[model samples]
Target: MNGDWLTRGRDGRLSVYQLSGEAVRCRAERAPGGPWTAPRQVGGDQRLHPFLALGQGADGYVHLVSWRPTVKGEAGLVHSTHFRPRLAALDWNPVGHPDKKGDRTGPPAVAVDAQGRAHVFVRNKAGGVSMLAQKEKGGWDPWRDLGGEDVHDGLAAVTGESGRIELYAAVPGGVLHWRQEEPGARPVRQEPLRAPVRPGTLYALATSADRTTLFHTGTEGELCAWRPGDKPVTLLDSAGHGPVSAVRCELDGHDCTLLAQRSASGRVAFAAYPTEQESAGAWWTESGPRLTVDARVCLATDEDGRVVAATLSPSTGQLLLTRRKDEPGLALEAWREV
Candidate 1:
């Protein structure tokens, strides 16, 4: 359950992270299309098969979250850390103990705001949501319960222009939504925005402009996104069981959202928006390439329009990074693993 495994720092560095072996590690390039440094262990308890969330604050600090499914990390705790985007290997500022009682249910989602505060949201074993925040200077605050029930995992969070932070997760009947308009302000609403799609894999289109659009595999393997208004937009006719992710890129002067999905064969594919600027509300998909069975996919943008992805291969349980360029007619070349 990785929220965003690849983040672009303010300094133009591209940092790639993944759950490697018993700990989480990161690899970075000095700038776009730059050479990447060797993978370096940032920090985490010695444990296997843990989940992670990653975000970069306005201050160019990369925030990391490492938590377990059944228990916390090896030290039996959910932990977090922050470090300079470029000099991360030289130093790490640990913001430990997400919950005082160390209670957790699944991997956490993180978002850092303009004031350099880190916000984390996660669902506990009881299916209630809890959040922990850490400001620029102070340590992590105590966990606060944001009441909701039976919320599925894969919580998503985003910060808005006016200090607004939004979080959403799947509930029994629909999505449970919450918002904090400003700092120190309580959540304005906590209710479900009806629609039950796939369970366990809730993906926020972090690649979308408003972050309001979400995509997940439907119960019957159909891919779904937020319709222009309330209804969900089902894209394509070949949807099958797969993983979903997206990246914002421009192709032939058309700024578009590149949607990636793995087919039953493990091949990833693509689709775009605004194909003709006013062709009605139609979204179509095209085949890309498949991945080996041992890999779980994650996508990122180089921020310069180059689409990048990193697949975690079980061979070494490390990221196998790839870069793809768009071809005419929205078709994509084979993903070249870097």
Candidate 2:
């Protein structure tokens, strides 16, 4: 029931993933924007945390990762792959703890490169960043330390326009970042951006082929948008306390970025604006009924090139989804329980 729960595959089928009873389950559309199928268990065990990180590559394979406590009571990471639209996920495989002593780890963040390899990142027990990457041929490389100290959990990773992976984590007084100079090359640490970002609220959107813009709630209780080498710009004053979900697509025949987040009143709010043009301003409009103040809202593009927003119901925990209406600017269809 995390924010990163929706994805679309190569065959134009949209899949919604959820974590229930420590097992990952999926409900996919029978066709693009069609009726959704029944829930099917995909992977996970009792040790799994409620968090799930999902990423899809150019080849349409969906990669999912989550944190689990090992038998030794130390935090560990497990990974699974969905090769096709309707196929069951591959068995959950341990990504292994960076520390042999099995020191507890944090939730994982993942991104798939252009070549279809999924790169996984997590906060190590020592408050630093560690990475494990999928090999070009097959198999995974040994866990490598990307190096950052005093870092918080809730890491964010995205594939850049050049197909290289970039990583970001919230630190005490600012944000730490890592970027690959070229596709398939090692990602090296970059200059950290100074901002008082709320931990567990770091979310990234690849606004363009090569550029990415980050959206998060600031420590001062405002929503901020930031790009590397640019100052953090405030987007909203009271964006609640959790993560902000964003997706980039064309709206009303114009390129735009759509964002969804819980408001201070415990309601999900939606906003749209020109991509990467935060200074032009964005207007936040309340959508759907009030949710818990901490509820997570997710935005993703469906197979039919329409925007979709998904969130969990407070009473029933059912997955509720709404789609962008065909007529106008930033309008959405009524919320439907899937």
Candidate 3:
């Protein structure tokens, strides 16, 4: 719920709010023991998209991906890039020095593993999803095709408990998965997880702790889940007319899921579902009270069963973080912007 908590790590180091609301103000410090350092700007004038953060596995190195307006060969393009985490006095220099020659109108998702490697997922104009990863030893690898030969909007990635990497993309017709055994290896595509036949699109994908199940939603205002063997099941359905963005994590020591979707009136409402099964089962159940927050926001999770959400208050255009009190049996805890 600290909607403003920019990025958090499993080790309890958090880079959180510090400066002008329009830009990202982040500071790195140990959680549960912090006198958080002075906040610093990570993305210069870039105006980063939601969910940017310092990747896990590397010390003092952060990875950022953003879509900025640009002119490309007489046409307009949105360029995305990755930056390294540095001190404010150092002016936030980019770590890997990657070339800025790509399109970014589509949503681009980034993930950094335990080795400080950078993995990027973006949908190109050709309607195909492409991935670019940077290894500590090698530079940026060539862009590889991810499936779905159509426009894709939402992308999510996570490192599983087994250390294998999994990626989810919301493509034109449905959702797709990519799994890799190790770094620099080819990713194998799982079957397409089709979205509902309603008039919505899949916007986000989050996995359970085991990484075997996935949760997703789209413009149709429905929250659904997909496991390895079963068909996608609708968890929460909304009569509204906008897309739904979702985040999943453990809350209060139990599996928790959060689904946020825009209503017909443009207000964003979030629903929470708690894990009902002790082992892998059919579906997650709604446990706690539903909460609504600012519409234009993003969500993330930390290791301690805490949820970090980013939302811009339309009244002020300033970013805010909502921190929820932690409680047992609760699947998700909101962070307040205290």
Model 3 CA deviation exceeding 4 Å by range: 1-5, 9-13, 16-39, 43-61, 68-86, 89-105, 197-212, 218-220, 238-255, 258-294, 297-310, 322-338
TM-score of each: 0.81, 0.94, 0.66
- lDDT of the candidates, in the order given: 0.62, 0.81, 0.50
lDDT of 3 by residue, 206-259 (tens): 354455556555446555667645777666565244345455666556565565
- By TM-score, the best candidate is 2
Residue-level lDDT tens digits of model 2 in 1-338: 32367788888888877777677788899988889899888863445777788887878888998877766656677889998768888988887876654755677788999999989887777789888899999889888888899888788898776677888899998899899988777789988888787888888878776778877778788889889888889986755667778888898888888888878777788888889888878878988877754456788888778898988643455677898888877788998778
Model 1 Cα lDDT, one tens digit per residue, 21-88: 56777778866777778877765344534567776665667777665434444322344554644564
How many angstroms is residue 29 displaced in model 2 relative to the true structure, after the best TM-score fit? 0.9
Higher-ranked by TM-score: 1 or 3: 1
- Model 3 per-residue lDDT at 224: 61
Off by over 4 Å in 1: 44-49, 68-86, 89-99, 102-104, 161-163, 206-211, 227-229, 237-243, 275-289, 315-334
List where candidate 2 sits over 4 angstroms from the true fold.
1-3, 44-47, 101-103
Which model is ahead, 1 or 3, in terms of lDDT?
1
TM-score: model 2 vs. ground truth: 0.94
Alpha-carbon deviation at 202 in model 1, angstroms = 1.6
